[model samples]
Target: MIDFNKEVDRLGTYCTQWDYVEDRFGKKNLLPFTISDMDLEYPDEVAQVLQQRLDHRVLGYSRWKHDDFRNSIKNWYSKRFNCNIDSEWIYYSPSVMYSISKLIEIFSKDGDGVLLNTPAYNAFYDVLRTNNRKVIKSPLKNENGHYSIDFEDFKEKCKESKLFILCNPHNPTGRVWTEEELIKMINICKEYDVKIISDDIHMDIVYGSRMTPILKVAEDYLDSIYICTSPSKSFNIPALTGSYVIIPEAKTRDRFENIVRYRDFVNSPAILSVLATMTCYNDCEYWIEELLNHLENNLKYTISYLEEYLPQLKLKMPQGCYFAWIDFSELNIPGEQFQKMLIDIGEVAIMNGHVYGEECEFYLRLNVACSRDKLIDGLDRLKKTIDYIKL
Candidate 1:
């Protein structure tokens, strides 16, 4: 039984969430409910595999195309989602973002419009901007706390866009896309000749919500679909730097391999990341199950806490991902002021929503993947910030 409440000290390890809060928040030692990485420990099996590889000490250029790597991923998808993944469809990348950026470059030209649902993963914005592509927004409708895509708007955007970037089990607002929702988006993109890039990095961690992998629904439309995902988010191993893309079309896969090998010169996988992936995918199923239960409890606590105390702050329990996207619009506080107050007055570091997109100005994304004790402290600080505002 994995102890999800175990508090692992990460402050001195050059950790981004704890040690480097000052970099983004401009303050040190602030309790951070920021950064997507978990405060929870990963499975011991991952560490054991990594240690076994480190004991060999060769550290040479490592290939990721072996049966061990491919079979582990294939079996995981089969067991977890009941989705069959072909070994040939899996190709390695250093990270999910890298694969998405490369696919954007491969499929679209500069100044070409890329359709994205607004209030997306903030990094998607960075990827589009850095690549010189036009960001065309099809904002999701927020009715009360529930979020759903506006297909009419999505269809209109797809007509003019060259590619559509999707965040399955979407970040900030964790709406796990239903099969019906995904099929609609896939068909719209197909009609417009728009290529699809589904970032399913947060595929795990779903709470009772079914995670319909875009590949599952895109059987006939495989040529236009690319699924970029990683075990990094699931296993808390982002530092290991391993991710992959699932491209069913042989010609498209070859084109992407050329970009990764020749253009990026990313010939070898990170040895430790490969080993960690294999171990976690093959051996850590129970760990994920336990983590999800913990997250669900944390999420329920968050929803109950807000309802009882800070009823003004609206939060809908997210269907997937361990993030609580709380609407601060009812507070009527300006986004900039609210963020500053959280940092300076409450001494807490929570992500302000405006960075995601212009539509999310009055929201905040809180990381709930922490020990329950730490989550309580963060919530208390948030309450303090609200109290100060009310006074």
Candidate 2:
């Protein structure tokens, strides 16, 4: 046993996931399992690399020489997924959300519809709506504890839609979509001429055997597929940032590059973050695998606890990510109330599923990336809260 719990207390000195977000809920203290950010410390090697970079001391403009960034990314992808990536496909910017918003502006004219599958990451809703763009949702099929995309609905949306935002290893639902699913999805987008901006930020955290980056599956059809990925999720360092978009064609790539240039957000990150990103990808495999194992075990423990103590609380163990989308619909309460009840009474602050989409009422998403003990404590608090409420 890796004792992932004490490690959190030891390392989470300034953890935003654990220490921050108190203000969001207006609480004096909070046990927040609401965030997607993990409470784990970086691997010692990554820490060492950053320290070494800092020792060099002058914070100045940094540029990538040769294939440093791409090579690190390529090596990580190959080792993790056996998927070969290229330096040519690499294009970067600071924000994936910013990049996605830019594409919404590019592909869709004013008031055009952009397709999203719900429940999705809460960020997408703001990203679409704040730009005065319209959001059209074709809800995921949630039958018998499994979530699947409604292909017909997706295709239908394509006729009226100009852009498709894909959350691979999807958030909230935690389905690490199969290649067959990705292939059919690609074909539908191709058939309907709906351009795809696939978000694979959770690409490296899958609980399953594989996660097919949309581009890796849609290789021949790459001109239409825009894949966004980052070391953020894998290394738990979104703040120290940059993300790359893989566009297969020169024209599509150039258009994005031009847009990024216009926005003035296109530039290589400083050595501090870029150096950590490079090292995290190139090294740190064992720690990542170990972390995944811990998360998988955490998910298993959560499921088992629910079955034994709270069987009415239903959730399928997600095939990817540490997010547990537990359906508390049987309680017949609004998801927000349930989340608040958990926080106010149970003292466990979790994300309300309603934030994901309209269909997610009466549900909550718990991030289980903390130590096993913290997860167990959260589950215990949840069990007591529900049991008391029911009584």
Candidate 3:
């Protein structure tokens, strides 16, 4: 039984989620429900294997070219998602964002348009802007709190862009894209000749509908699509810094590999990172199941707490991911003002949704992957501040 209740002190480990929040907000001792990583401990099996590898002390250069690493990924996809991934299609990278920036460079040129849904993962915006690619937003429609892709808008935008980046089990909103949704989007992208770069990092953390990988549903479009995934989010090993891309088409795979080699970016997977990922895929299913149960309880508690203590903040319960997308529009406060009040008076730090995109103002994305004590403390602070400010 994995203990989700244990509080881990991550204040001084250079943890961006906990240790750097004060620096980011310029407020010391602020309760952070912001960043995406969990406050949970690594799975015991992963931790043990990683430590064992570290003790070996053969810290020479390594590559993930072995069958053990490849088979772990293949079996994981088959067992978890029921998707068949060929070993040859898999290639390692230092991180998903690094792979994505490279994909953007290879597939599209500067000033050329790349598409995304609004209220996206914020770093995606950074990638596009840094690469000098034009961002074409195809905003998702919010109907009675559930989010749906505006298909017509997406189709129109596909006509204007040659590349589309999809975040399945989307960030901030946490709606797992259905197979039908995936099919429709794939069809539109296919008709318009748009290459898709699907980010499926959050697939393992799903709650409601099972996540359908674009690769599984759009086999015919493999030549123009690829998936960027990592065990970092699933296994809580971001510091290990390993990610991979699945490109089934040889020509595209060769082109991407060439760019990586040319840039001398053939980053060998860390010894601990490789062992951790292998452990996650091969030995940590039970731990992940327990984690899902804890996350479900956290979501329920958060929704009930908000309804009882702060009904003005409407929360759309997430179908997947640990984030809660909350609507504070009824409070009659601008998002920037609301965020500032939360930080100053409440001493709570959460992602101000406006940074996600223009349409996300008045929404706050709260990360709930923490100990129950910490969660309750943050909620209490949030409620106290909102009440105090209303008076």
Candidate 4:
């Protein structure tokens, strides 16, 4: 009986989610529903393994590849996604963002168009802009809270873009890309000669359905895809900063590896991160199952709560990630204004949707990866703020 109900005091551990809220917003005691990191404690099994490794105290420079590391990754994908991953395809990275940035630099050039669906993970925009690549938005249609990609528009955009970063189990929106949808994307990218960098960090967080890896579809089109994934998001060990990139083609993999080497970004991962990752993939299935159950219940509660009390707020329940993509347009307030109201009156921190891309100004993305009591508290504050506005 793991205690998902126990509220961990995360205030003083230099936590960005909790400790930095005051600095970022000039508000103390703000209920943060903003960052994607879960509020739940990490699995004890992983922690125990990490501690055991730390006790050895050899902390010297280490290597990324080992039989155990590769086997753990292979087994995880096999057991979870039913996807056969050739161990030869796996290459280590410090993080998913690092891999994406490196791949962006390798595959595309300054001013080359990087296609992204609007209301994407906001960090992708930062990565593109910082690298001097042009961001091409192929906006996802928000048809009354359900989000779907427009294939025609997507294809048109792909014609001009060099790379497409697909977020399966998309962040903020939480729409898990179906196999049919993924195949459609692959076909379009194929026709346009556009390469794909799939950020699958959230691959293991699906609620009821299994995650579909783009690599599974990219077998025939191996040269056109790069799959980036990490256990950080799945196992709550992001601070450990360990992730891997999967490149199916030997030439492409060599090219990527060469870039990593030339750029001096190659180094052994933190020993603890590797150990924790191996422990997680090999030993944490029960913990993940429990977490999925808890998150699904939270999703259901959020939907029912919105309907019962705040009908003006439309929620498209996420199929995978813990984020709830909520439409607050019925309140007739701008995204900034709504965010201001939430911060000032409600004192709740949520990511405003507009930052994801243009034309998402009426939406707010709430991180529901916390305990029920905290969730309800945030909801009550939201309700109170809405009621006050109505008055």
In model 3, which runs have C-alpha deviations exceeding 4 angstroms? none
Summarize candidate 3's per-residue lDDT along 1-391 as a digit string, tens digits: 7889899999888888777888767788789988778999989888778778778988898878789888999999999889998999998887899889988988999899999998899999999999999999999999868999999999999998979999988997998998889999989999999999999898899885568888888868877889999988776789988888998999888888887766666756676777788889999988888998899899899999999999998887788899888888888988888888888999999888887998889888888998999999989988987998789
Q: Model 3 residue 329 lDDT?
A: 87
Give all candidates' CA lDDT scores. Answer: 0.92, 0.82, 0.88, 0.88
Candidate 2 — which residues are off by over 4 angstroms?
1-3, 10-15
For each candidate in turn, the TM-score is 0.99, 0.95, 0.98, 0.97
Q: Which ten-residue region of model 1 has the weakest summed lDDT?
A: 205-214
TM-score: model 4 vs. ground truth:
0.97
Prediction 2 global C-alpha lDDT? 0.82
Could you tell me how far off, in angstroms, the CA of residue 162 lies in candidate 4 after the best superposition? 0.6
For candidate 4, the 10 contiguous residues with the lowest summed lDDT are 259-268
lDDT, candidate 4, 1-391, per-residue tens: 7778788889899999998987756787899988889999999998798888889978888887778888899899999999888888888888898889988988889999999987899899999999999999998987777889999999999989999999988887888999889999999999889999999989999988898898877757777888999998888998888789988889888887877766566756787888888899999999999998888889899999999999999997788898888888889987777788888999888788887876888888888888999999989999988998999
**lDDT value for model 4:** 0.88
Q: By lDDT, is 2 or 3 better?
A: 3
Tens-place lDDT digits, model 2, residues 47-120: 89878878888878777534887788778778888877777878776867877877787788878888999998
Q: Pairing residues by index, what is the TM-score of model 3?
A: 0.98
Clashing pairs in 2: none
Candidate 1 residues 1-391, lDDT tens each?
A: 7889999899899999999999999999899999999998888998888888889988888899999999999999999998888999999999899999999998988999999998889899899999999999999999988999999999999988999999988998999999999999988888889999999999997999569899988967888898999999988999999898999999999999998988888958998988988999888999998999999999999999999999999999899999999998989989999999999988999999998988899998999999999999999999999999989
